[model samples]
Target: MASPTQDGVLEALRPIVDPDFGKSIVDLGFVKNLEIDGGRVRFDIELTTPACPVKEEFQRAARDRVSALPGVDEVQVTMTAQTRGRETPQGGEDLLPGVRNVIAVASGKGGVGKSTVAVNLALALRGTGATVGLMDADVYGPSLPLLTGVSGRPETRDKRILPHEGLGLKLMSMGFFLTDDSPVIWRGPMVHGLVRQFMSDVDWGELDYLIVDLPPGTGDAALTLTQQAPLSGAVIVTTANDLSLIDARKGLAMFEKVSVPVLGIVENMSYFVPPDLPDRKYYIFGQGGGARVAAEIGVDFLGEIPIDPRVVEGGDRGRPITLHAPDSPPAAALREIAGAVARKLVVLAERTPAIADANISWVTN
Candidate 1:
């Protein structure tokens, strides 16, 4: 085994790139120091700015990289703030109360299974032993109640909107407020205010994950989530259809402009299956459009879910596909997506979040 030296350590640090600057800390002057003594490694990680929330992350990455070197025995990492300017405004250190990791599931166009992904992802996250909440921010089309199978209006306690429940998930949706006969037709600010109230006035109660289902398009609703509060991240839903990918790009660009990280993209309806004949996938739309978009944007291609009638049937039945067919191909895809998202949140917590779990105060005892 080669001896642990500063040069070898520096070589190992080359790939740990900063998300804000897109450069290696070793080359970008963020790595403050490197000390190696008989396989014991101690390093100081200095961020480009003092407002860096990812300090812990850079430290962890450095430890992992250096610890993998030929003769490293123990690793000690320290983080110090040193920067050229303000850190990237990807949300901030202080997060919303009673909401730990808030992820918005969005799409460019409707009928692309955005809410389905939101419902199943939240459920799957719960499957990982994390308490989760689902909020339907789609005022024009609040389908969470339909998907999660919770109905009736949310009651109020001291003017706080009570959230509903769905198979190990706490939930809120516009459907719980308005009747099927009524319609919501306000502009951007109004839509934004309604969502803000959902965040502020609802009794979300201690959640490790709060999955928000937003209406399709890069419209007022999407703008509200990006502008009103700090979001953990966003997942863009797409399909193998080129048009959907194009729309997904618009939504992705919105997050980039707001400095929020794109967690990844989900390819829904990637294939098709029949009840009688199961071994065939009819590429009814196109092929690999979501994967291509993820590659182009340099983000993770979480995975794909086949277009099964069961998916829609499950929704109509108020049961997510993940709940019924826990091992089916589509459910497996959603679970993989939920897992990918769960891991990314851990990284995001190091970068911009200080609290491990938010929305604890609102949890029902």
Candidate 2:
């Protein structure tokens, strides 16, 4: 029997295409470190993100295809990721030079659990072995310190603020500097300066993902973030109800006006599954509002998160459900949403051209 040459192995895997990029894995340069000895075949399939939803499918397909070769007896497929990012030029005034992707988690209005969703999503992304950072960009109502149980003023050295570390994530928030009852009565310019400082003056280090929990509503803080932050994409968090959906549309329009891609809409509190009735889903906020809005607005419907009391309890205690109760239904849904967000960012990075300055142009309304 003839040995399987590198050319033959590459040909065998050419049929497996990346669903997002519409190109074969071989053609996309995902296959790496190929080594063949006797009947043992070993290679690594490097994906764009650690949180890729289809990585297992790629692994299975690669093993099956290579094992079918004439001289292949054992196939070892190692899955890896380099976490693709937008082509932001390094140095020269790039704010987040070391951060690859900056994701804004926003909502149309308050009371939609946007902070909860952002906390869990950041935890979920970090769970996948990606270096993640969570920035509470809600200058008026910074909740990350409460949600992640991280407090105390961030230390500064050489004029750069070092982000606080907690729950395996680099954390930054205005709440850390304020007392529980303190109010942020800053003007629009102050909010803008604080948001810009969070990006440029914070030492976030090298992170694969930086999840910014933007202030709810398309107001000054949101506008400033959309204009200054080199955001790769934005995720709109909304409840499955008319009121929330209305604000969700306004939020979507805000991102669109600034030329930022809306990764998708995540419907939080879509339904409630009672502990007694594990199988029954009570659609308390009406049915399919999120999907309806996504379809109506022509964006991806990421997924729905069920209303679980534990999610709130955990957040209140600085333990997001995604980190503490990962096997729970709500946690699973949040992780799925995180995966979708990661995948959508990869798609945008692949389709969009690299810009010299990552900061988007401000559109006057």
Candidate 3:
């Protein structure tokens, strides 16, 4: 039997292409640290995001391809990721210099569980071993401190405000600055200043993702964030109802107007699954409104998060469902949504010539 040469191995894996990139893994230079000894083969397949949904498929394909080699007796395919970032025009001087992607989680209006979705989404991303930060951009109603159980004024180091750490995530929120009864009665300029301070004056060091929970609506705070923040993408959270979907469309329009890509729409509380009846679904807020709106607007329908009581309880206690009850249906749905968001960002990054050039490692023929 002949030994499998490096060129032969590359050829074997060339047929396995990334669905998002529409190119061969070998051509994209995803196969790394390849080593061959006798009949055994070993290599790592590095992806753009740790939360890639197709990682398992890639791993299976690579293992099967390499194991089929004539001289290969064993195959070791390690899946890894180095999160890619959108290219900032300012480069290293950008406010979020260490943060790769800034994702805004917004809603059409309040009372749609947007903050809950944001908290759990950040937690889900962090669960995937990605360094994540959560910024409650809702100046009027900051929820990060309450949702993550992180409170008190954040300490300042030198000239930068240190983001409070909780639930394995770096967090910043106006909630930390106010007492429980304090109301933010600031004007538009003050709101803008606070949002800018959160971006530039905070020390959010080296994060794969920074999930910004934008205040519900297309008002001053939301508009300010969309304009000022170097947002990679936005996810609009809405309930599966007509009124909520209406606001979702407005929120979607806001991001579009700012030239920020809307990654997709996440339907929170899409259905109610009673604890007693685990197998049954109750469509308390009508049905399929989220999907219909996404289709009408030409955006992706990320997924639906079923209404779980634990979702509220977890947030109230500063323990998001994705963290405390990770195996529950709602938690699973949030994880799926997070993965979809990560994949969408990758697609968007690939579409941008500057970001694509900076992130992709192309193999020469």
Candidate 4:
């Protein structure tokens, strides 16, 4: 028996609609490189985002559809994702030419461990064998220097700045430029310039994910990032407290106003466990507040991070908990949250192609 034609394979996959584009995969240009050799069939599905949510569903649908054809002995499916606008920033220049996805980690207020989550999330992504970068956009209170244990100013070659490297991830932050513990007294415009410079000036090479540590609140730096850079989406970090949730909603609303999708909410410092009495759980900050807020706002509850003293020590020592204590409960939780956030980003990336469309204007310079 002879194998089916490539056209027949595509015809079978016509019913599979890409969840993000609201059109058939065939129409969306997702189905590609269809090849059939005797009883073997193979093809690739090119997705809009690496964090695509319906990846599994699409694979199953495509495999089953192709295998159902006559004389089909085995069906092989491969998926590859890429972003269209990452090379172009708002200034009509290619900033991060090799980067694929940009994720902003923001919070409604400070003191909620936002930087900690960002640092560890970057490390976890690196653990998954993907190239990653961590940028501390918290100009006023840049703590990535402390969290990642990287100090000193970045070097420049040929006028392009190189990011400080640590924990197997490239990094850029205003923290490296400041001295002592003094505050940055810049005006709104200055802050905006710093954000733009961070995105444009840094030489962040091809990255699977660039996790941005945004300044807390829905204020200047946050506004600058959403407008100046090409972000895949934002992740809201909040504690398990009523007031935190109240402020988190504002942060979520800010992203919505700019048309940047909120990937999900992460409840930080959700609980604690006593080392001596290892069996007991302590609700230190409160409970269910983050999940409730996510439900109220119609977003995903990514997961929770427990209040662990070691998390603080790790930060102080310049090693993220995810890398310092990979076996601890908090480390396990952080890794899980990182994976969830990554997956959601892929899904949101496909759904919100307009975000890339809005800010991305390719310039042939």
Per-model TM values vs. the true structure: 0.69, 0.94, 0.93, 0.77
CA lDDT, candidate 3, residue 147? 89
Instruction: Report how far off residue 337 is in candidate 4 (Å).
Output: 3.3
lDDT by residue (221-284, candidate 3, tens digit) is: 7887877777888998888764455676788788877668899988888898888888888999
TM-score of model number 2: 0.94
Ranked candidates (lDDT, high to low): 2, 3, 4, 1
Give the clashing pairs for model 3: none
Instruction: Judging by TM-score, tell me the better candidate of 2 and 3.
Output: 2
Candidate 2 lDDT trough over 10 residues, lowest sum: 356-365
lDDT values for all models: 0.75, 0.87, 0.85, 0.80
Q: Residue by residue across 257-322, what tens digits does model 4's lDDT show?
A: 666778888988888888887667788767777888899888889888888888988899998898
Q: Best-fitting candidate, measured by TM-score? A: 2
- Per-residue lDDT tens digits of candidate 1, residues 23-115? 788887666667777978888876533334465677788888888888899988887742121122333332346666778888888888899
Which residue window of length 10 is worst by lDDT in model 3? 356-365
Q: Give all candidate RMSDs, comma-separated.
A: 9.2, 2.2, 4.7, 4.5
